[model samples]
Target: MFGKTPAKEFRFLRHIAFPLRIFLLLLLISLLLMAALGQYLSASFEDYLTNHVRDMAMHQAKIIASNDSLVEAVKNRDSQRLSEIVGKMATGSDFDYVVIGDRNSIRLYHPNPQQIGRPMQWTKPGALEKGESYFITGKGSIGLAMRAKTPIFDEQGKVIGVVSLGYLVSKIDSWRLDFLLPLVGVFVLILVILLLLSWFFAAHIRRQMLGMEPQQIAQVVRQQEALFGSVFEGLIAVDPDGVITAINRNARKMLGLSSPGRQWLAKPIAEVVHPASFFTEHIEQERRDVLCTFNGLNVIANRGVIWSGDELLGAIISFRSKDEISALNAQLTQVKQYVDSLRALRHEHLNWMSTLSGLLQMKEYDQVLAMVKGESQAQQDLIDFLRGFFDDRQVAGLLFGKWQRARELGLILNITPGSQLRHLPEGLDSTEFAAVVGNLLDNAFEACLNYPESDKSIELWLSDEGNEVIIEVADSGCGVPEALREVIFDQGVSTKTDAPGEHGIGLYLIASYVERCGGIITIEDNEPSGSLFTVFIPKVKIIYGSSSNDSDC
Candidate 1:
């Protein structure tokens, strides 16, 4: 029987191989067991048959011999008469011989006619001399048989003759062939059942093992452990009791632990919790990322409650080092800002190309040249003006691109002349400034769409005179109301009812960039009737240089 056959208890059979191997094993065992059982049963049946036949033959012979006529015939040496009686009695049965003789143990009748009137050792000597009726096995001219001898008596009650009958042991053996066939059939059935059970259970075990052997599963487990340890983001878990339950290697490394993750096991996380109130505040705020200082290093972390069934089992925390995340975020923000700055410009470029194509079809070569020349000068003038404020070409490109798109949006976009942003410390590539400037410009352009084209204008002023890059973007559009100013830069706040998700990210990006750069941004009213977003980025001394990748375009 398979071990643990109860449902829901799964056991992988390590010894069971492929299906063919299981079949062969079951076949071999079944054959061996059936052969053993068959031998035992056959031997037992042979003994039983011998006893049964001997007892039946003895009983029948006694019934024939006790007759008065049988005694008289034997006493007269009446061979023919005795033969008639014996042959008549033996009819319609499997008896091999019926012999009648005086107590001298001589044969009177046998299937072999020549044995008549000859002496027979029908049974052992004691059966005849003592005139005792008994059974025994004998061998004579006939091969071997189980013979029964019964005594006959006249009215004086003295033995006058012995009647003997036998069934050949070989005949009994032949009859057992009928039993052997069905026995073999049953054994074959058992063998087949064993084979089927083997196949089914073997395949089931293989599936339970996830189509993998134990050694392969062990290898996978080890690989998974290594993967979890090598992951870059940190992970931590605490129980409902605030005990540290699970912490990965990355979590320990990110938290600047001198020991490994195990050293903190089962200990209260409160002892080393960053920002003492982080866990409480996170749970209260419904699980959001928080900035905290861990062991003197800044970290961004999130936490959640772990649950099992309906029970709150614990909390889980994931955290990582701030420097790497901040750097990655900056790169992503810069890319997004570049895309946003170009998106509007790209939209209007299609119109410009269409106009130029129409002009070319008309064969107005002079007009075409004049138009192209004016466009090139305008582009050059914007670039020259931005470079005059900040020598970095990346910043200059952003300002030029955003202004051109702002103009297309029908906003009178201009830069304040001689603003001291021209004296920005030599080292600023202005990626942060670019993010802040581009997103705000995009936001300002969108604000103006709510107003008529005549009321729209964006004036940007920059100065670096006070150890800061002071920037202001003034849009003559709907001014920020007092209530809205508090959360104007929250990621999903939008004044436009056009569509969701399309209009909110730009201002949020500007706010995030300003915060990470240790700069300040404020939204206030412009002079007449619009909004002013001002950014004051504290000056940081930085050196700038050109690289081989730098291009004039």
Candidate 2:
């Protein structure tokens, strides 16, 4: 009947708080177990009492049968003598009655005087004649009882009569009840204790779960999964033991792991990320914008700890590819360079306009025309030269802006003749190319600033010829010291003494880009006192229709 109830009837349980649900379920289970145990123990106790009573009755009957007086009394069929002996033995005993019977099954002695002369009721057929001693349960003169019968023998060892001792079934049942009451009390006490324990246990579990139900927790997990998957940055979460607890799709992809995140779950973070000290070291401290390599991919990573009150739970690391960061930096540098170039051009134009205005006011028409023609032709020629050789507009614009910037710094800038770069090498983009050329040129300009205006000069050479793009930049300035030359490309190494942190990263960044492209760069002392930096990047054959590009580099 309970099974036939509709499932919807119990659906309200889902709405209940987690602790109450757990307590109720535990209580129900405890009650069921206690009921089953109570039933079994009660039945067992009753059976034990019944067996004990039956055994007592049989023992008493045997003792009565062995008595020489009772045997002689039965042999003579003396009811008075049988009663006298049985009464003495029955005093201070547990049995309900003791009866003595003759060979004809006539009662010689009974607990009741009226039963003494009556034929014994419920006697087994031929039991007295066959001299059988046994126990039986049956309705007798008194009531239903467990009776043990023992045969009596004469001096010749022949069956004379029987002695029957009985205990009432109702009395045995009463004894069972007397024992069961205490047992029931113990069971009730145990059930009450268990219910209290269950309530505390359930409350503890609820607190551990942040007081949320199973359904609520499930919903939270789903939301977290969606959020993690949708994020652009790669994310990994590890437990306090350094085991991976969660990894997002972007994390797996960034780590170059093709297997699903579930396959990597519970694995040690060290196994997934090499040199995992970034995560393991100083775990309690939050780290941001840390440059580290994960599975051979350089990434800008940040790590933060997960906490529960005062306890440390674990840590989460979010990272993105360093190449992406470099790209963004490159774009921003290009924009700043353009802005500076425009500012310098504006200042230079104002000076030229001031000169032109002065000449026009003096009415020196010939000098004005000559100055205008010369300035326009010079600018036009440089623009045409850059457009003709450098096909990429970004690289061409970078060169033009640096040339203008060098002029504004009162330094002569020369682009070596026959320099040609038709197309950038494979794996190199225009923005990165611009960054490389711009940094080199900026360094040269800074170096030249140390010399007098008349003596300051910077020269740039670019050529994509015979399977390699070669670039050389030479500047007349205080050259790199012999001691610092080898470590010039290392981060935090620079000729400029001011700005300890800000001035050293440019060369390091250039070296990084160069190494990633499988290129070579070298620094040499230019004749007549200056530094010359040369770079060589090999070119690869391109197949236009292929999905994957093949590069020897």
Candidate 3:
């Protein structure tokens, strides 16, 4: 009662090391094949030897029957003559024995003298009656043998006798064994070589697989997919030839690829990522936080190489859209601006409180009232102007904070005459607009603070008189150098040299935001010794009663 199924019985094979398992399987197959081949060759050899011996016996029998001496002896009933002729032919030959019989099947000559007069045993009557020559295997006077029988004919063409030539089956088998021994040795040698090669091949294959089992490799692939899907950043991996090997869903989405990621596989990285130099150039080293453009979208990218020992396999690139980075930057900038405004207000309020306390202590109540009136009127006037001109609350708040910030830094900030904004440009929201304005104004403020002039004043202008919204910020500070003016908006290019990574991204973010909104920004020299930055953004057309807006700005 064999209870175990084949699968259960062979389940232990799963635990074997992959190379060993391969070797064992290959060895088993080779052994089986060689065994079957050996059996086939053995059987074929025996058949060939039997046929060869039979053919030789038949030819020898015919030749003996045709001999005039043997025929004359048999015709004259001379047994002595028959024995002499047959003995000479059989000696030192492959035949075991030769027998001559009369037409009546009486033995005329035999290997044994006593059996010469006896009738030959196992003789077929048809062979003699029909005067035919044939071959058969049968037990005879000596032993089991393969015999050829030929009928002898007289001068008158009448059957006078029969000739028989025989070879012992046992002797033929012994001959076969002797011939096959060397071949068997060769087969064994070949089998050994094959097994060795199979073992080596299996070991080589195991090394290529990094010694991981098939199941483990599959599990790792699944884990990689999960990790790629779960990550927020886009990821792409390339081989040493710069062909894309793996790309995740986020990468496709960020690159605005509509087709499945598989379609991009094996394609050149340059075909998918514009300006792929960040990945292709200096591929041996790791790069971090490198800003680059991918498919026309600004992205913060990092690249690292994959290595096996000292061999460079490929590289993996991880990146996210600069919009996400800009959003974070916008929030941080707002927070910093808010804190700066609070600090500036706190310091100014302290000064006001000290003045009021001094007036109270001196008992100058009239001066205190006048000072309070002046402060309230000035604050109310500025608030009224901002509320009436700027429709967006975020932009209004930003302008107010920058104004206070300028005053706190001992700089005059001016809102140019007859400047107003009824609507922001299309595709540009208040948050982004605030970031753009904030960065420009902060840059101007920094320039004025760093390179102070006698007239350290900054001018802000805004207009939405036509299809485009225009903004200009001019500062009496260190203007951009002629060498840097061309590349000032490029990432990592900045007039400020104090900090490396921090100071260069503001203008880049501004330029990127403006470009996305179909706007243009330009820089020129201010009248005296400052830079004037102007932006013109196309606005969206609004239908008075319709809900939808078109791109007819």
Candidate 4:
């Protein structure tokens, strides 16, 4: 676990570097190369100067040692003659000094006027060694100088004194500078060219990057808006600050927002959208998810953090209306209620039969007979009515459930019987079919119950017409207002004023289930009074056959 690994950074790093980075990298590399070249040129120039100085010393020493008169002149301490000799040699060669010194190791014949008898501790080695040249550097009374010395001998071959010559090294240093000047000049020129190249490439790279073109990005944004706007549910996006950044066309329509004159863009989210808890909840919990109804619109929102590298940029939230969620839940609850009621009724019926059996065992025959006759007559009438009204068990169950519910609500339900239709759809499930019947019954109950006791009335009629199943439920209650009829099936559109917590989803649930089951619904004013709602569903192809039982009585 502790072993070194390749950097995790590069794995996620795209080509994130900008043009400035390229320019700087190239400029730094060019500067380093120029510095290295300048160092190399300086070293070569120094070596040239050292070699030239050594060569010049050797050549001057040979020329002075070949003169025999120079040796005798050095032994006599003749300064005037040595001066003349050095002057003459200066004209023929580049040597600046020639001197002859006595055997006492003192200068005898010298170029300087004051040193004719000066001791020659600086050149005694060359004075004793014949034809040998010695090179030395020293600071004399005149200044700093480099000198060459050689011993001069008479015709008898005995060394008498020394011949000395000197040359300054300042000239050699000047020559070295002359050689390096062009190299330095070339290095500076190369740097300028590199700078220009870096700038040119940096500018070109900036143009090539897609981020440089804002118009293209704007076009993409427009396309995304167009695509999302056509969707059915309303969608909204917000930033970390709870500001509404974007809203699709559907969302704008649902919320009654207009973009033409209003400043919707970049507006504080709370101004356009209510229920700030959508964003705030996520921020505090690090889990930005909210599903709630706000200002009559259901919204499900999700918030997530936005990040670049190790930096936290902010947060983004995306949400849509929760209408579908509510619709599904309502439908399920209605079905569950129906099933529970059916089970309870079945259990109660069993208990009632057991009670009757105990009464019989106690020999209370007259009391039991009277109670049985009353129950039997009621049961027979209900069974007879349903047997003639609905042939499908799926539809029959819904009708029975609705009857039970209406009695509980203190409403009188009227039923009209019709011949059983033969064919039914194959794809229909029992739950969906039951919902179709249940919703109609619910609508009938709600509509009739809306009237005062003196005006309450309900009628349900069923029949088949040319490959279609038709049902009509009419109530002796004030009909739906004409203007609001078109919107009755919409979620949250309800006519009931007395029912608390009623979202007006009954008609919506009915319409939605019918559409899903390939059926349709319509509404109209009943003749003379009240409202009439009709349902038409395509006949299904059924292969099975069954016989109907007589009325329970």
Candidate 5:
């Protein structure tokens, strides 16, 4: 029942999630910045309050320090005078309480008339000994307050008594409320403005998205489908239940289906195309970009498991034809088998010839001569042709295989030997190296025989550089057109049209193999009027062997 449901859901989420997520992330960052700034400003304001109270205490101490008359009055326990002086000082200043303490640790004068004659039992012992200022915070008659002590001095600057000042801390709370309340209100206003901006952005994005109509959106989707459908690759989608929910034009054609809605679920997709088909598991497991083969067609299939968070949806699979890859593999396999057979034949034939030579050398010539005149004489040229066909032992058998194929195509072959050359590279794999040479020679012969000429000849030349082996093949037939020369090595581009079921992937395979074997190939215009293809294979270092010996056939 889930028909193309997950794809649409994924598309919807992709469009809507992007903008909303961005807004939330920005909002989070803004909130963190505002919180940090608020905490810092609050701490600075509290410190400012504490310092102001301390400054008032120091100012009171200095006033007493400058007045010798006030110190003399405090020393004489002049309560009326001290009280009057302290009351006047507290009048204009921010202090709410004041006290004068003498050297006997007794309160000589206090702003409160009732405590004037009382002992200051709360005075600390180290207050005078340490000669350091002290600050205290407590709840007083006037709510919360901060108190501090400062020593007063006589004419000689001796600490005779202390002037103590107390200021209402609650006043700091009132001051902070006066300034901070308005500031926080303004910040809240700014926060509202930012929230409005965020809302406007979200709305603007929504409005832009709403500009496109449903039909216009559908048109865009259809255009995408048409574009992807026209390509050579195939696209398929399967549901979690293993049902084929969608198949593109190429995919349908590739599967050779006539009807619509290919029901592949519960039916084992192998029934529709075959289980051995590549890309089936990608649909089952929801994995992508897997290389697979279908029937004889090589294809690269990409799998994407459709998932919504932890929820598993169906899978979408897309595939492109890899006929070139399959063709290359097949060609290499054929070359391997062909070369193996030739090598076996060479060993067998050498044994037979050696026996014949021994009999003739022993002067048992009558039997040997008769045998030579029989089948040996007729097959001598063919045997000699194959023996000298491939000079490089590692690749000789492969060349022999291509020779027969060339002759059958009515193309004349010419082979010339090189002087003893450097050994082939040690790292080159024997079978792969042989395949490269054989494939190139085969392609050259095919190109030469492309012309409808009664007479055609292909010439081969071999030589050696200091550390490189060179091969040149030239044909006396129609050469490749200059315009198509650059594209000849590309897969599926070929000049041959007569061969059935051939997709022109041969030269691509040849070039791929040549490069893999550490060699280079170049096709150029021949001297008279033909194509000359040259190959250079680097010579590998030899451990215990001499350079390759050459022979021409």
Candidate 6:
């Protein structure tokens, strides 16, 4: 193993970690700045050189044209005299060439003597023919040059010839180099400083990362993937710009996405999660537990800020389905209520048993028989009434629980004899139906407590006829106030004093569930006394109903 390469060793040198990447990023930015600066410096130098060279050339040429010797030579129409004066002037000046051309554009003098007496060739169009002083840059007999041309006029004001002073483009560059050399030195020095900083940062970052090998970093990435994948709750991580950087399978499931790599990653958070408000805020403890209907799932989210040392990275959101929590709570509450109801029934039965035992122990057999028969008939009537709806245990248990609660309060619960409910109603499952029935019965029972024992009674009528299920609950207590009747079904509108997490949600739940399944609920006054609540549910399609195969409570 010592002879072999370490598995975590970097195979290539370009393994830039986060800090190193930052350093490279800085390097790239500095390089771009240098390039832009170089371009600007080069352009400015060329412009300055062009103007300085042109002005100097024009001044020298104008001085030569004003000389008496050049004027006398031109007046005599003497090419030989013109050549001698132009040759001497060119030698004395730093200009590349001082040439004299006749008005017919015949070159009388030039730096290249072989070009003399030839038609003067200027690279630009209309060169020297416009008879005006100007500067132009182009290739001539002496190669590319920036030349100043001025037309020489006779005393009669007629143009006789032209004089030109030319400076090589390369010569202009020599002057340009004066300023550019210092700029280039500064550029190189800055680049060296940048490189030193980059190297220093690279070393610092390497130490911080403990010089982890490529394989080790890859292993860490895999570990992260496994960690996120193994989580039960949804996990999503976003960048500072609100783009999803990482999302787990559970997140995909919660978000109703296609798969892990199907553009979900790196997509903007707004487009991935609906309503955009779910993960927009910097969610901490006080702001955590965001409840939103995102991606068609009711999720309760807890968002935490992600940071790298002192820098803020983004946010990590963990969420669970609200349906899961609700289901668990519902189960626990149902079990507890059922147990309480059964306990109340057992206490009542124990009292009955005590009375029957006392009667049997005495020497009163006929009175005992009459008492037993009366009790048997009442219990049988209650059983028969409940058996009508026993096809669904949820419905049976709900009504049975209500019956026991009424008895504990010493209130009469009357089920109309004309009522017939065969099974769970259409469009609502047993649990849904039970919840609706239970909440109504609880409200009725609470209302009945407002009256004296003699007047304490609740009337429940259930009938399934003509493709509709009708439920009516009439309480013999104070009727609903006329002013509050309109908003009675709204959430948090309970008539009772609210305790923590225990009040004002039942009616809201029932109304929402009714609306979901397309049903109607109404409130009316019961004859002679309290309030009558009637619910009409149409039988169309029952999708959430409990079947015979379902477990019994």
Compare the candidates by TM-score and give the number of the best one: 2
Model 6 lDDT per residue over 1-553, tens place: 7645754474443555666666778799889999998999899878877788889999998888777788778777687888788777777579977788777778777767788788876723454466678778889888899888887777766667778788998887777788889989999999989988988987887776767855688999899999999999998888777888899998887777887444788789888888767566643223477777777778788888876677777888889987666544544565676677889889988998888898889967898889889978987877777886556766777777778878998887888777767755555777778777777887888788865532888999987777878899999878789887888777557677546356555676677667655678999988788899998877764334655322222
Candidate 5 lDDT, tens digit per residue, 1-553?
4978888766764554544755665677667867787778878888987887678676776676457667888767787888777766667676677777776556777766777666654456677665667777776434567777777666766677776677777776888888788878877787777777877786676565555644566898799778757876777766665556666778766666654544443454455665533434444465455667665556777777877566666776777777545555656666665865566556656766997989978989888878778746645654565455444665654555555455555666666655232345545566555655665566666566666652577777765656777778787667778887888887767766666346455567656655554567888987666788887766753332332221110
Candidate 4 — what's its lDDT?
Answer: 0.67
TM-scores, in order shown?
0.46, 0.83, 0.75, 0.46, 0.38, 0.52
The Cα local distance difference test for each model comes to 0.72, 0.85, 0.86, 0.67, 0.65, 0.77
Kindly provide the TM-score of model 1 when superposed on the true structure, using C-alpha atoms: 0.46
> All predictions: root-mean-square deviation over Cα?
15.2, 5.0, 6.2, 15.5, 20.1, 13.0
- Candidate 2, residue 32: lDDT: 96
Winner by TM-score between candidate 6 and candidate 3: 3
Superior by lDDT: candidate 2 or candidate 4: 2
How well does candidate 4 match the true structure in TM-score terms?
A: 0.46
- Clash pairs, candidate 1, are 427-542, 427-543
* Candidate 2 deviant stretches above 4 angstroms: 1-7, 218-306, 312-335, 349-373, 541-553
Query: Which scores higher on TM-score, 5 or 6?
Result: 6
Residues 320-361, model 2: lDDT tens digits: 997676656655765788899989988999999999999999
Candidate 2 positional error at 456, Å: 2.6
